[model samples]
Target: MTDQAHHETTAPASVLIVDDSRVSGRKLAKAVTALGHRTELVSGGTEALGILGEMPFDIVLLDIVMPEMDGYAVLIAMKADVALREIPVIVVSSLDDEIESVARSIELGAEDFLPKNFEPAILRARMNASLARKRFRDRELDYLRDIDTLTEAAQVIEGGAFHPTELNLASVAARDDPLGRLAKIFRSLAEEIYDRERRADLTVRTLRGTLLVIAAGSIFGIAPALGRLASAREIPPLGLAFWSAVVAAILCLSFSIGRSGLPRLKLRDLRFLTLWALLLGCLYQLLTVVIAAHVEASLIAMIGSSRGFMVFLLAALLALERPSLQRFSGLGLGFAAVAVVLLVQGTGEDNDLLWIACALVLPFLLSLHTLLMSWRPRHLGAATTVGIMMALSALFLLPFAVAQNALFLPSLSFGQRELITLALGASTAAALVLALDLVVTAGPVFSSQMAYSQTLAGIAWGMLLLGERLSPLAWGALVFVIAGFWLVKPKRAGDDFRITLRMKGNG
Candidate 1:
């Protein structure tokens, strides 16, 4: 009681302290009040929720190991509620080594976690930090709101004055002199909107490329680690499960593509389209899996090879369309970068030459698919295209999968492993292919740029997670890829000539 009285004398702050024990709750309330903060004491999560509804509080001090309504449940409820979600929650628990509890609390949107027996100073510091974060979030939200308002106003102005046809004609007749000025203003507003939209589109494109690259890199890194786990029998069920997942993912991707509604294909589609192109895109993964099963080529290398082919095909297709020097340079740099990485990190003893050959051939097939998809105006939507392709690919590969005994669904002793594998394969792979299809459909340059990004991401993920080392040559390769991508950025005529002159001057 004396300790509580001594503490209630700082700048007034509102805190809701929740604990099952009445004595402990009172102790916390008194201590919090001593720090010049008003404290609300609640016995459990249910009461805390009720109190939260009655009035706003600065922070909630939650107890993790509670009764019916545990701290986790309370935290989740808080996060789910738009009105209560922003309130800072500090979890005060007796359990010192509750890593899962702490992780879960944080994930459920808890602001901070503190040991129940923490020092007064530590408690104060944690509270302050949480409050600071809340303030920062508030400011960010405010900024976003203001920006949204401005964007809306700009859009409305750009959209022009809304008038009925009858009124519009009357106004035009009455205000002939002002009509030109109005038109000019409207045009200016429209131009600004267009510029803003274009910038946004470019940013989205760049972000999409970055995300895909990261995903590809991550998948590559995971493949080797998962393979190693499988070999060790540490997670054989998981490995087998992942194999199933990969098949399912391929099937989903095939479905997406077939349903994508590509322009009506005629006999002429085959003339322009080589079987190699389809094989390249489609068979690479099949080859990758076979090699991964009995070879030493790193997953990263395979992913890079696939990406390289995809980019090469895109560049070639683009060059065919536009016949640009820049496009050719991008293609060369992309391949050279891939080569450098491969050369520096020589193939492992387990790496079969045939497998590598198969992997190399894969991109051509993928490129063919991309090129055909991009050849004309899309007849099918993105979702349909991805679905159809995935479905078709699955059908085409079904016989092979069946023959190899890889498609068997044995009774699982490990449901969790099976689910994880399914999620990784179906969700992750399907999402990636869908995104890639969208990027490729947008433009060849966009697709190629994404490949470079993916390679870098893969390298990063490998180094961080899988203890994969990048050689000096590999580093150089990365630099070349980045530089090449920059060099290939679309330029106006004046900029192109200027760049050419500078190159000549350097030479």
Candidate 2:
């Protein structure tokens, strides 16, 4: 225990003397002070009450017969106030009025009665006993308060979401007692559980991130085919982009509102949101729609798959990620698979250098979008953030679509065009929201690994929906994507598979 606390527990008692007679008051003050206690003197009940109101005293020596507000009135008033009622009060009276005074004082809630000419020894015994009781009561109150704190700490443990410092048991743990020892043990256990929970959470988050990446990749893979179909109907790039963004915005906003309430955009977030919309909604969408019109869907997917490599390179250059040989090799293999699919499996116009160059730009924009999402405001939820971005994109595209006179509005009827349009918008909303979530739950590089799944899903969807064909060499290249995906996936902390493999070889 600290010296201050020890001193407080064993401190001298403060006694208040309230008497009409100045001589008797002074006498009692001298006697009390001589017993190593602190004493305050007041000539009447009103003055005594005023002094008591200002400060605390261990005991009060109140004279029965005071001029105004006698000791009985003072006792009744003190007992009425919860703050003063607990203080020990002793009423003083001379022999003549001792019986009546003592009976009335006890009825008025005084602790005991004292003779006006009481001996110093008797005064010491009575005052010392009262002081001891007051101190014991104080300690009991403190112990109960600490116990309540421990109960709160127990509830926090049961809640399963807390930091070690959040237990708030420092004061109780500081005491040199059995309860203090229990607090120390409980704190240590809480810390251990916190550490274990973190490790478990890390593993769960990694798995969830992987699932999000795959879901986003599969949804995004359908976009190229949709764009090609829209192109066949002579849809303008800006018109297609604008309509798709509007649909996505509507769907995302509804879900966001229902799930997390409407997004409140800050002035600082507007700049980031605007830029995000421009890249993903305006520029990227325009390029994607234009290239999808000319390029084969599978080849588009192959070129888009290079986004992972771009993100890896950019992240390394920006010092946002440490370059690892294992990760580099895995991404290299994925990139090589994309190259093989592009070069070995080609149809008419697939060899157009201009369209291919434009297609490659898609991955660079996607890489930048991935990194930007990582740096997004921490407060924005995935659905709300994506909803806001899509909404802004629709706003930005409206003027351009109008100026180009290429605004494509689907009919209210459930026609083929409307169905495709709805599908396109719904897929875009799901993909974008999940992508942002993956970025938050995992590192950007791991999130970018979705490119491998996107390539595979795109090719499969092309074959199933568009009657596209892939050669034997293209099929073999897909194996590389799968292998690379496994290599680049997140591992538990302190796990290094490459080192494990090397050690096994040496053994």
Candidate 3:
């Protein structure tokens, strides 16, 4: 080794030590620290797994003879994990069949083996080599991902952008390495997306477009209505969302089973599914419930009705949705409506700002979910995707509900109003999500216009049930919301068919 590298020490990487022996763990950790790396110590294999689930380490040093789950079992579990598999593991044990143990651990994906009384120099050398190998592997993976994204970009140029997917974005100007090649790729994608938008509209169509739009609308419409109901009943937002998400998950799973046979779950699949659920299912859903309980019905109606405009704007910025005059005009109308509502409402409650922030964040997260949906593996049917998200979301929310004493509050005590409200909310939530999947499947654009239903329902329920009144300005905003929907209503089918007929005539 060069004197500079030897003198400078290895880069500080995190290491996880799984050993039952306090003396062994402390000695190894001290050696790791002397080599300028961070160390974490866990007593057994199961504890190691739980800690790894919460955070990642650059390398794991596992002992094989521990009770219950030993080094071999832990090695298998790590290899089965999508996120952790890339992290190299080194087994540390002293057994009669040391040679056989080393071979088995390697097969289970361990990078190296160490003796219980390992020499300090050899341990540092092996760890450094493993870290180097990991970095090389990462670069190769990044290259493949960039190339795959480029292929998708080519498909857009060929006019197959009905369900355009967005590429992951990063500011590339700061980097001056091979990874910088991705910057040019990003610029090329943006240019291609812009060119396509200038050429012609890409329509996703079905004869049932209008019906799907209304169905999606009605399903989403119930959210605001139910929020107001929860406010009246003094029920907590967490409970309302938890049960509703549980029911929605069940309904979606049934639909998915009807479409695709039971899925064989893979490590990567579970990882991705959990991520999606955390964002839309738990974070977004919980926030929406809270926002609904706090905000005025008129304000909620105005914002809720603007979902289409939000989706359109989000997709356009990501270069996934086309930028057209009608869509732009629709966005303008939606913004104008929001402004009018703001002027009329004038932040009636001290916490209206908080409500608006929560409402805006919910749709932002949902828009992100919609964009990413197209990128998921095609074999994971839409119903299955939706089902996984709802189910995981329910699981995420359960602990919070239990902590708040919201779960089964009405069910156990038989508070008729709360029980009925819970039932209505859960049933509507399930039906709404199922309908939403179908709508987005056929046409993302039309499905987005479900905002109109949400807006109208927000107003209707607030008025008829709550006896709420709207200011003249708020009323004017309502007009803008209606007008925006009129401008961007679902397009007639057969536009593509007409083009084909024209080509035939020319021929």
Give the poorly placed runs of model 2, Cα more than 4 Å off: 1-11, 20-23, 148-168, 186-195, 221-235, 246-279, 290-399, 408-426, 436-507
In terms of lDDT, the best-performing candidate is 2
- Poorest 10 consecutive residues of model 1 by lDDT? 492-501
Candidate 3 least-lDDT 10 residues: 494-503
lDDT, candidate 3, residue 106? 90
TM-scores for all candidates: the values are 0.44, 0.64, 0.49
Candidate 1 or 3, higher TM-score?
Answer: 3
Instruction: Give the clashing pairs for model 2.
Output: none
The global C-alpha lDDT for each of the candidates, from Candidate 1 onward, is: 0.56, 0.81, 0.68
Candidate 3 accuracy as lDDT: 0.68
Assess candidate 1 and give its lDDT: 0.56
Q: 198-258, model 2: which lDDT tens digit per residue?
A: 6776677667876887789989888888877777777788877888888898988899899
- Per-residue lDDT tens digits for candidate 1, residues 40-113, read 88888999999899999978999988888999899888989999999999998888577877888888898888
Q: Which segments of model 3 are wrong by more than 4 Å?
A: 1-207, 258-267, 334-351, 409-446, 471-507
TM-score of model 3 relative to the true fold? Answer: 0.49
**Each model's Cα RMSD:** 29.0, 9.7, 20.9
Per-residue alpha-carbon lDDT of candidate 3 for residues 64-95, written as tens digits (9 for 90 to 100): 99988898889888889898899889899999
TM-score of 2: 0.64
